[model samples]
Target: MRDAEYCFWHSPAHKEEAAEARRLGGQRRRRERVVNAVYELEGMTNVGSVQRLIEIAVQDTLGLENSVARNRVLGTLAQAALRVFEATEFESRLTALESVHERRGKGKR
Candidate 1:
C-alpha cells in the first residue's frame, strides 16, 4: 500500500498527538497573557515585585524542555534573583547607617 505523505497535524495517525499539542498551546497562551497583564499592572516597583517576577519566570522556564536556551534563561533568572537579594541587603544596611547617623547628630546637639 502506498501511503500519502501528510504533516503531523493532518496525519490520521497523529490526531491524538495534534489534539494534545493544540490543548497545550492554548494553555500556554492563556498563562502568558495572564502573566503579562499582572506584570503591567504591578510594574515591578519594589524588591518584592521584582522577586515575584523572577520567580514566575523561573517557574515557567523550568517547564521548558532542557536545552541551551533554557539553561541560559535559568542562569539569567538566577542572577536576577541574586541581585534582588543584594539590593535587599544594601537597603537594610543603608537604613541602619541612617539610623546611626541620626542618633549621632541628636547627641551632638
Candidate 2:
C-alpha cells in the first residue's frame, strides 16, 4: 500500500507550494518584529528622561540593521536628536545670559 502520509494533497509533487507557504510565514514574522520594535520605541517616551529616551531610540534604530525601514527611521531620528540638542543648548545660553544680567543689575544697585 502507498504510505498513509502520502495522500495526493500532501505528496512530494506539491513541495513547491509548501515552500511558498513557509516563505510567506517568514515575511509575516519579520513584519511583527518591526511592529514590536516600534512599540518599544514609543514606550520609551512615556518612561524615560529626554536623554534616556534619545539614547534608547538611537540604540533601537541601530539594532534594526537589516530592516527595510532602518535607514528611513534612522534619518528621522537623527533629525529629531539634532533639534532636541539645539533646543537644550539654546536654553542653557539663555539662562547664562539672564544670570549675567542679574549680576550686572545687582552691581548697579
TM-score of 1: 0.63
For candidate 2, the lDDT comes to: 0.75
Per-residue lDDT over 52-74 for candidate 1, one digit per residue giving the tens place of the 0 to 100 score: 88988898999999999999999
**What are the models' TM-scores?**
0.63, 0.52
Superposed on all Cα atoms, the candidates' RMSDs to the truth, in angstroms, are 14.1, 15.7
Clash count list over all predictions: 0, 0
- In candidate 1, the residue pairs with backbone N, CA or C atoms under 3 Å apart (3 or more residues apart, or in different chains) clash, namely none
Worst 10 residues of 1 by lDDT: 35-44
Model 2 is weakest, by summed lDDT over 10 consecutive residues, at: 40-49
